[model samples]
Target chain A: MARVVVDVMLKPEILDPQGQAVQRALPRLGFEGISDVRQGKRFELEVDGPVDDAALARIHELAETFLANTVIEDFTVKVEEVAEAAK
Target chain B: MARVVVDVMLKPEILDPQGQAVQRALPRLGFEGISDVRQGKRFELEVDGPVDDAALARIHELAETFLANTVIEDFTVKVEEVAEAAK
Candidate 1:
């Protein structure tokens, strides 16, 4: 099996309240020097076959259409190295 | 400035309803061949200075104590390349 990873993040211009909450909490927890924090989603997909260009294209389409809302978010799709157990 | 990425995922044995929902919806959307799906969180942190070993260690502690619930989740922290605009 092949593994595909899709990372979906908000647009740079967008405000991320969830991340902001974490950033605000950091100082109270004694972790400082972090200026910004952005929270996003990561999806790991186990594909049943080889991850060729065609497969990658399809995954990209899935990421764009189903995984992320293009109005406010952007996503990246890439093939990750399969684990030994999955090979 | 430096960018640090923290990825938090559910333990392998834990139930992931969100991932299951996505996996079930894929076939309906005409995307097939994916056998499994796991969903996780990705945090992008912008640090105000260099990301040295000490900084990474602190980030790790922060991740463990504040970002993730250790009982059911696992987290990995890494320094990511900062974008030119962030430099």
Candidate 2:
């Protein structure tokens, strides 16, 4: 099966409260020297057949419509092959 | 500045309710031929300086302690250089 990976991230201008919270907590946890922690979402779709252009376009549409909030977030879709299990 | 990417996903054996919801909704929205949808989280950390081995290990600790639930989810960390703005 082919895996369609979608990465949804907040726009640079958007304020991310969760990220900020993580940043604040990191220092308390002793993970210093870090800044600008932005959190986002990822979706991995296992497609049944070949991953062609048409499939990709549809996935893009899905990303725009359901996966990401275009007004404040940006997303990208990528296709990958699922590896076979070893004996 | 450097960009550190942390991708957190549910384990293969674990059940993903959110992903299944998306898969079910897709057909209703007329996007067919998709199966086994898995959803996850992505964290983008902008480090103030270089992303060396020491920095990476700390990030890994953060992922384990705060970002991912090691029992049910898995996460990976990747570092990239921040792009320079065009003049």
Question: Candidates' TM-scores?
Answer: 0.95, 0.91
The regions of model 2 sitting more than 4 angstroms off are A82-87, B82-87
Q: Is the docking of candidate 2 incorrect, acceptable, medium or high quality?
A: high
Q: What is the C-alpha RMSD of each candidate to the true structure, in Å?
A: 2.0, 2.9
TM-score of chain B of each: 0.92, 0.89
lDDT of 2 by residue, B1-87 (tens): 789899999999999999999999999999889977999999999887667788788889889999999999999898756655541
What C-alpha lDDT do the candidate models reach, one value each?
A: 0.93, 0.88
Candidate 1 falls in which docking quality class?
Answer: high
Candidate 2 accuracy as TM-score: 0.91
Residue pairs in clash, model 1: none
iRMS per model, in Å, is 0.4, 0.8
Q: How many backbone clashes does candidate 2 have?
A: 0
